[model samples]
Target: MNQLGSIIFLIAIFLFSTFLNWYVFQAVKTLTFGLEGERMKQIVAVSYWLIFGGISIWLVITFLRIFQMGEINVQTQTALNVFLTVMVTQLVCVVFLFGEDIVRNVQAGVTYLVNGSNGFSFPERMRWVSGIALVVAMIPFSSFIYGVTKGKHNFKVHREIIYFDDLPDAFDGFTITQISDIHSGSFTNYDAVQKGIDLAIDQKSDLFVFTGDLVNHKAEEIDPMLDQFKKIKAPYGQFSILGNHDYGDYVSWSTKEAKEANFLKLKNQHKKLGYRLLLDENVVIEKDGQTIQLLGVENWGLGFKAKGDLEKALANTAASDFKILLSHDPSHWDEEVKKNMNKVHLTLSGHTHGMQFGIETPIIRWSPVQYRYPNWAGLAEENGRYLYVNRGFGFHAFSGRVGIWPEITVIELRKTVSSME
Candidate 1:
């Protein structure tokens, strides 16, 4: 257990390192690139850093307030702090979503500054111009919190023939809609969730898949929003696999037994929602005398995570068969699927959430999630294999989605005689 805690801390640093690097680069660019492109880049770069850094900083602050404001003992304070931190984070997740507009405006500023630069390299003149523009851009920066609170969730839908393999006659053109990380307690608006679910349902999916982190930390966080989630039903049934959050792995727990008990309870609740919980296991869906093997592993990855054994899950399979894997993290695509595993045609995952913030554009400036996952927010295929990383169905610590709106991915698997050459 101590080893796991150390591992998580290290992974957090590793992931956060990208954010740190991005910000430092922007700060230097803002200081050096006295041109419009540089200035605009500066705004965008700062905005991106602030959004990622701000939430984390706030979470730390919340933890302190929850335990420090009153006269609580060290042990009691620790428990309360963990609970309140998760709760409050769940309550105001929209702030994180709101960072999108800030990114958009900053991206726009990048364009403006690029033109404004006019190629003047005098340090004294450059400082004056950048300082003023940076101040003006702060207007949008300050307003970003408001935009997130204002209840806006925007997204783009990208679907394609990422992986093409032969399917049995019964399941040609089989469409599977998968979504995950619906941290319901954090969402401010239920309607946005409904819209995403509606989009998935529109695909007439044969199977509806949900990777975990359905609620903040407890079932009650989402009890009020079941109506929205319940809307995600399909012909092949809604199936789910757990993520790290689903296992209650984020906090300091009193007893290992209690934590494991909570996980079991959450798993049971999922069953009540009409979902087949696939924990380190596989199930075969038969059609037209052909079998499509669906293998789901527990939350396994390169660190101190849950036990997700893919080989064990697919041990009984014959050498050749149509296969699809459901492992939440895309890292699994690298760690497991791309290795000794069979020619798994299509692998579906959603741990990224795009982190819920994508890239910035003129018409669309959004999240930094793209920089994190190469196969980050959409369908990606390479080397005769494919992976669809769903942006996510719900928000995380912040309630809303900015440029990276929550996603409902409808992936259609078709039999192709022609190779993807």
Candidate 2:
């Protein structure tokens, strides 16, 4: 954005946050009105402002740094996460407080109408209402804290069995391990990340495929944990495809050549990690005299990068061959892959990360991202084609995961058995 626009946006955010702080402060004051000593109340008021003021200052500085740098550093990202967590918790408290205020005003108006000769005064704020608001706010505050501390690296293996009518006989029961959106720049705990890599290795699938976003902005971000990721190997070989973030589009570079150079380095990082990076290309995987086609395209998504060429990836491949495609964004499947005449049997993607927060259980599955991307996570089918979107292996802008933890997917491809047989 331009300078003026940036300034306006910052000013808007500052005003909104200050308003929230003031409302929350009022609730705090109401709750502490009956404190035993004047000094104790003074301390409470001072402590509340100090915390909020410190966070406000930190947010302004970090936002300025991000605007200047065109990218957020790990420290700044963590601080932003903290800011969001606290803000959201405060908003929850505001909801209850606002409700109580509305009721109080209504009661005062009723009293004025009933006794026309005497004026009605606004009632005192109830300590119990403020207490309830504070108590309820703790729920989300605790969840956000846990998400940052542990849930980000809490890798969960999602096992799926996909059946294909035209699957190659020799490839039946084939297991493929998939992970996506590593976002290496956002990682802080090397050992925790290693544990996720180790879990993927433990799956011991026939093939491994990474759907992309290896780094947040620059390829160098992966340097620290390169060795750990390199250990993820499979019998059929490790393959990968690019995601939108892999192209350095989000960062402002001094020159076009610099951006290109960084992208080339990121591509090479895949090779160094023993992955064959496919850019709008296809390869054949043969096993026990039967073969299947593996096609990978560059990042393709609606409203994002459109570098992937499905036609090019399918070039030189037979229409009758069982095809598994690797595309980073799930939107590709919704927009083109499933509708393509090439008849791709399966597609793997992982760009949503389920918004890094949601509730998923045996009875219900829901996330805000669902409204944006219908196939945000797990499996979906259209006609006979299947798409599986991994929930990602690492956190990103938020620096944490809530109900939707990092995921390592193990998919077993099964051939349909004839009922007559």
- Candidate with top lDDT is 2
Model 2 misses residue 59 by how many Å? 1.1
Over 4 Å off, model 1:
1-60, 66-132, 135-147, 150-152, 304-306, 360-372, 418-421
Give, for candidate 2, the lowest lDDT window spanning 10 residues.
115-124
TM-score of every candidate: 0.68, 0.95
- Candidate 1 lDDT, tens digit per residue, 180-231? 8776656655676567667777777788888777765655566777666677
> Model 1 Cα displacement at 243 (Å)?
0.7
lDDT of 1 at 77: 34
Q: Write the per-residue lDDT of candidate 2 for residues 1-421, one digit (tens) a residue.
A: 7899888977877777778888999889998898899999999999998989778777877888888999877878877898878888999999998999999989888888898647657788999899999999999899889998999989999999999989989998999999999999999889999999999999999999999999999999999998999999999999999999999998899999999999999999999999999999999999999899999999999999998999999999887989999999999999999998889999999999999988899998998899999999999998999999999998788998889999999999999998988
